[model samples]
Target chain A: MAVYTEIADEELERFLAGYELGALLSVKGIAEGVENSNYLIVTEAGPHILTLYEKRVDPTDLPFFIGLMEHLAARGLTCPQPVRNRAGEALGVLAGRPAAIVTFLEGMWIRRPRVEHCAQVGEALAQLHLAGEGFAIHRRNALSVDSWRPLFQRSEEGADTVLPELGAAILRELDHLEQNWPRDLPAGVIHADLFPDNVFFLKGHLSGLIDFYFACNDFLAYDVAIGLNAWCFEADGALNITKARALLAGYQRVRPLGADEIAALPLLARGSALRFLLTRLYDWLNVPPGALVAPKDPLEYWRKLRFHQSVDDAGAYGMDL
Target chain B: MAVYTEIADEELERFLAGYELGALLSVKGIAEGVENSNYLIVTEAGPHILTLYEKRVDPTDLPFFIGLMEHLAARGLTCPQPVRNRAGEALGVLAGRPAAIVTFLEGMWIRRPRVEHCAQVGEALAQLHLAGEGFAIHRRNALSVDSWRPLFQRSEEGADTVLPELGAAILRELDHLEQNWPRDLPAGVIHADLFPDNVFFLKGHLSGLIDFYFACNDFLAYDVAIGLNAWCFEADGALNITKARALLAGYQRVRPLGADEIAALPLLARGSALRFLLTRLYDWLNVPPGALVAPKDPLEYWRKLRFHQSVDDAGAYGMDL
Candidate 1:
């Protein structure tokens, strides 16, 4: 829960002057996003999200992120459409940070996502992948297989402090992934972080997907792998085959996977697991003193990686090639 | 920014089963309140705040706080009226914490409060005091003069760790206040923590007062003192006489101050300052390891206490006695 920057009434009034959004009724700092300051902005017209991109987000990459939302939104996807000002620009500056207002989507991200929720999310993910077909801009997946080594190196020295065998385990996984990672398959813009938190639902129906900051050009099937790792796991650290089958079946309903994509699922899943594990390990080892956000348990991803290592075929994930 | 407790969608749905509020639309965790987990709950009926009272709040005091809001709102004060569920209960349990749904008031708390804002706050405060005449629930001020010594003792040993002469300075101030603190004044249920953040304004008009957790029986003028300390201080720590005058004048317009209450303003302000200082000092010295909330600067209150010490007359605040 964070609102790192405070926007004053006078400043907000001045900032909204550029937009056709009517009189500001209220502005509340939402504590959802970790990478930016988000406010639920209500105007005389309607509710919108006013986001001030923080230092964690690269200003240059914002065009890709905002443009992706616009592109996908225009393509019949239910995402937050970036509200352009009267001057036809979607982005502006406020409180010394790059800011923009997007139409507020009405849905809650389900916690304890059931099998049906997983299926809805799967369908939404496929829809998002299809919607990105014609987007002009590109953003590279920064936390992909290639970047794991650097992140691992940064956290390696103190990795054992969290767990005795963490450093050695990471090294072994990194070596195995770098050599065996899938090289060729279907690729497009994927929501690299399609965790349950980023997917919203309205009464068992997929309302929309959000947080496009992590969307980038990557193997579209790799996104499916990420979703499998994210959504197919139970609270007890066991894989739920029914949910996995439902999610994959839901996705296939919209866009069927190719034979090569199906064959490469296990390897892609391992790579996806390793990518998250390295990043989490890095964050866990390097959490600054007095940080507002508690570093998530890196061991969770470590266990997920181990499970992926044990799986030798796509059929184990409740899918058949 | 706080949402210590995470409420699951299922848990929330079950909790709302008793409420007549239509199907839930969204619930966004609000990062505003310090002593609770607040979510901006949007349902088919309308917007409301779902607050889970945190550990800092004593569950026994829930009745007083909740009842005060109900009474005040019923008397035409525009505060958050507690929403009763189908069972006609304003408070229930959710996520293992005491929870309630309150009507969502529309307005923003001004960050840089102008004189007009201060005046509105003063008038609203007076209205609140007037409206509270018949409230049956009685809660004693927990941070009043008698409680300061115990709080000071808790932080006394390490007080000098924060500053060289701080420990001795606090003892001296406590000695002065204990000997001369007023025993006779207009006493009533006061909004004991009427900081600027607790007051809301809509388009420069005073909307309402909120956060009744700190409401308790105390000297009526002491609430004014708390407001003066909170609202009259400029960014540079200097007192703004214009704002103070506006606040006091606005209060006088609704409820005229007694001669004794006017005479006791300086001392009450000093006591108010010390009360906050001691609590902040204790918190600053004892912030638990890995605590989500950062301890506020105790020295800010020390500075306010010192400024109040320099004032020889109530006129120094702005209005003529």
Candidate 2:
């Protein structure tokens, strides 16, 4: 729930002049993306999302994100397509920040996703992976296995204060993951952060996936691992194997996972859990004064990591081998 | 930029069952009203604003707010009209809060309002006051002149911490306003908080006025005073008399102000300035830690109040005598 950059009306009118979007009807700051300011702008043409990239987003990587969305949408993937202005540029500057407008997707993300929603998300995820093939740009996952140790090191000193012996536990887990991380797997553009909030559903049907800021070149199965950690966990820290089975089955129906990818599921899940835990831990320990967004609890991911540690193989996730 | 209430997708779907809005398409938390959770919901029927009343708003006043809007829109004012459900009800409960859906107005509020915009706002405000006549449900202005002293008393101890001698100045101004406050002036439904953001403009035309939570029975001239303080003041704390002239002249073109109303303008403007000042001062001094909305600077109103105090008569506000 943020609108960091306030755009003046005249400035916005001037900015919209570059586009053939017609006269601006209304521009409302939407509580959507956390890293960037998003506006659900309505014009004489129709509704579109006007996003102003904040400092957190690397400008160099924006082309990749925008290009990936365009590529995916072009291949019949349900996603927001970047709308090019009359100048034939998809991106522009507004309020002294890099901004772009994308066609508004009509759907709401499910809060309490049911088994069917999970299945739909799985199918959609696989479809996205298939559609992302041969995208011209490549961006490495910044929060992948390699970045965890450096991220954990920054938050290590204060980690124990969050949970008992948490710092020591993370250090041990990081060492194990760094050594055992999968080197060769089916790699593609993965929506690294396919959280439930980023996936929209309408009338019990998967409408689309959004927030491609975290999309990068990574193991396609690693993206599924992130989805499992994000969607398959319950409030009591227990894994819902029924939903997991449904999710895995749905994905296999679209694009079957390789033997190596399936073999690495347990480790990938653990790695995904660690990735979120490290980021959340750093944010929790380094919350600046008067920050708008409260840091999510790192211990939730810690508990998730522990659960993955208990899983000995992909079978534990109810994957049909 | 706040979304205090998190409405579940299932719950929202169930809630929408009562409305013939054609299966809910999308609901996005909008950064609009401060005292309520507002979502820009779009369905087959079209876009509407769904607002959940927060704790700040009194539940008893909900009827007056909704009824007044209905009344005003029926009278041909270009404000948001309350949308009734199948049960012919405008209000309902959503996420344990009183909520209602209103037609979405199409226009953007001016960030830097020009003299023409001020004229439009002035004309529109006068139209609102006239249209609000004969509204059966009457609500007293909660933050009127009578409430200032008590409000100031709450923030008096820390007022000077915001500005040197702010507390003393406020106390003196409160006494002056309370004693000299107009009585027996023409009274009707006044949009007491007619700030620029509440008024929307499109293609150089006044589209509508919104946020009627502050609409109440008060002297219509006092609403003009608020408009003067809000739209006529430049960013640097100086009054733009040319804008003020256009504003007052525009209002007179609709419903001419009586000599008594004109004479009371300066004192009413000072009182209006003090009304906002006291509330802002209280909020500034009493901001809760981790509160999402930052308290507006109280001294901005203090400066406006000081300027109002220097005005001798309505002519000083560029009122044509």
Candidate 3:
């Protein structure tokens, strides 16, 4: 039996043959991943990325994804726009898997991200949130706190592996989080995965962003918290003041944060941390034996979730913003 | 096409037809996941979890999983053991996927864990490390420093989205990380995914551990660092003093740490923080469309990683072992 599968190049080529692009030069399967098979396609009209949906992706969601990206792009968000075929549909089958082409974003994602890089992400996130003001499509924040209890149910048997007291603590945290969760904040579309790789830059200037798969309507500050969690952390688990300040400052420049956003940051951060801890915890329980998929260390998010529980002040995360 | 596929009752029943345990009662696929399709299976053999390997699991590693559980079970680690079939193999094919039966543990993972609870986890972790030494199999820590580059590459495309300075900071951190990464320390198999859920308990005592997907050889202190990253954090992105002390004290009680391990902890913590930051950052870049996967808030990790970079002493991380 096949351990892993991928879409065929010829199949992908056949699917793209009907696209509007004048020429397709490169169709390279990027070997750098374990999820979807992605081909970097260079065309005479322009460069684009073709991704063959893998097992993790449900084929039915293809339209939603394509539509989401197109919607965000139309809203002035700098994300990949799905290309339509002669049928004016972005959804198509390639290699027996649902697939489509997305315009290749131009800037290289910095592997060696610096403190200031986080600030730029903060700015882009602010813009993304602002641009998401009236997006036609919507998706529930799938990893929200309301869903934690069910995730807990799946791993309930192994609760002792964490602690006999954990069940209560988790429930308590959830309750506390529920009571204290931020409300009355700027709500809008968010690039829920604003990791450095998803945001692009060129010659010291913001270029475009890609990968809006997790985009959803949520708290604006939660987006900032996600960026803070990703961009400002040091290797030893310390919060970099300079990086945090830079990110906040940059974000405020484009879209000044409101008081409620600041007030809600601590809880938002906790919620976000818990979200990761839960998912990583779930994945940790069930990673495949031989699959190269790297299992995320839930311990880190566990710590962050615990840390976020301690925060009461907005300043604890950064300068008030 | 089935948006959520069901494990056929006939197939599931036949799969368990002749088990010494008895007749099947019910099985329901649990969704809200990206990997395995888990069924809450109840049979004459008793209630057990039926996990259908989906996207991420490779079949070859099933034996290691099967073996590891058996080994842990022998060593008194409370965990689910893979049930062998009538043919005597622990693994089987089902629904076009690799499958297994694991006795469901009973309990709930704590979300808002207390300092005392963290202390318990710390002690349990040390015990796990001690028990890990006797396991027959050996696998090098795959998530060692070598893993960071691939993750960095994944996020390299959109590096400047957050900040241009972040790229330099990341390279500097990596360089500093390489220089300070611990090479000389106690090495043994680790329950690498030792989050709260993986641990099981009855009332107040630790009972069992479940997920061993990330088990491997690495600096024992690295495991401590993992714990520190998990249990010693505050909600506002700072370290929790009491929880930190409790956990470290508990760990030291069972397995006294070396001075070198103690001294190297600040760096170790930083490395641990970076490991998660890079992975989280990479995940941030790669969320699949239409999937329920939530992109973890990278900002919290960013905060933790930056903190690690700031620490110059193990004491900063509350290491006393």
Cα lDDT tens digits, model 1, A1-321, are 433688877889999988998888877888788789899988888889999998888999999999999999989999999999999999999999999999999899988988998888889899999999989998998889888898888988989998898889888888888898878889999999999888888887889889999899999999999999899998878889999999999999999999989888888988888888877888787777667777788778778888988998889889965
Q: Which ranges of candidate 1 are over 4 A from the true structure?
A: none
Cα displacement (Å) at residue A236, model 2: 2.0
**Candidate 2 C-alpha lDDT tens digits along A52-71:** 99988999999999999999
What class would a CAPRI assessor give candidate 1's docking?
medium
Q: For residue B67, what is the lDDT in candidate 3?
A: 80
Candidate 2 deviant stretches above 4 angstroms: none
Model 3 bad stretches (over 4 Å): A1-321, B1-5, B30-35, B162-164
DockQ measured for candidate 2: 0.74
lDDT of 3 at A265: 77
lDDT (tens digit, per residue) of candidate 3 on A1-321:
102334433454467678988644433333323356665555667557777677866565566678778877888878788989999888887656777888866554555567667778878888777777766766777766678778777765665575556556667777888777766677777777777667666645667887766667778888898887777767676677688788888899999888878877778877877777776766667765444345667767766777777777778767763
Please give, for residues B1-321, the per-residue lDDT of candidate 1 as tens digits: 434688988899999888999899988987687788888999998899999998889999999999999999899999999999999999999999999999988888999999999898899989999999989989999989999999899999999999899999999999999999999898999999999788888888988788998999999999999999999998788899999999999999999999998899999999999999998898889877666677788888888999999988899998776
Ranking by lDDT: 2, 1, 3
Candidate ranking (TM-score, best to worst) = 1, 2, 3
Q: Score residue B176 of candidate 3 by CA lDDT.
A: 80
- Worst lDDT run of 10 residues, candidate 1 chain B, spans B1-10
Model 2: residue A221 alpha-carbon error in angstroms: 1.0
Worst 10 residues of 2 chain A by lDDT: A287-296
TM-score, first chain, each model: 0.97, 0.98, 0.89
DockQ for each numbered candidate: 0.76, 0.74, 0.01
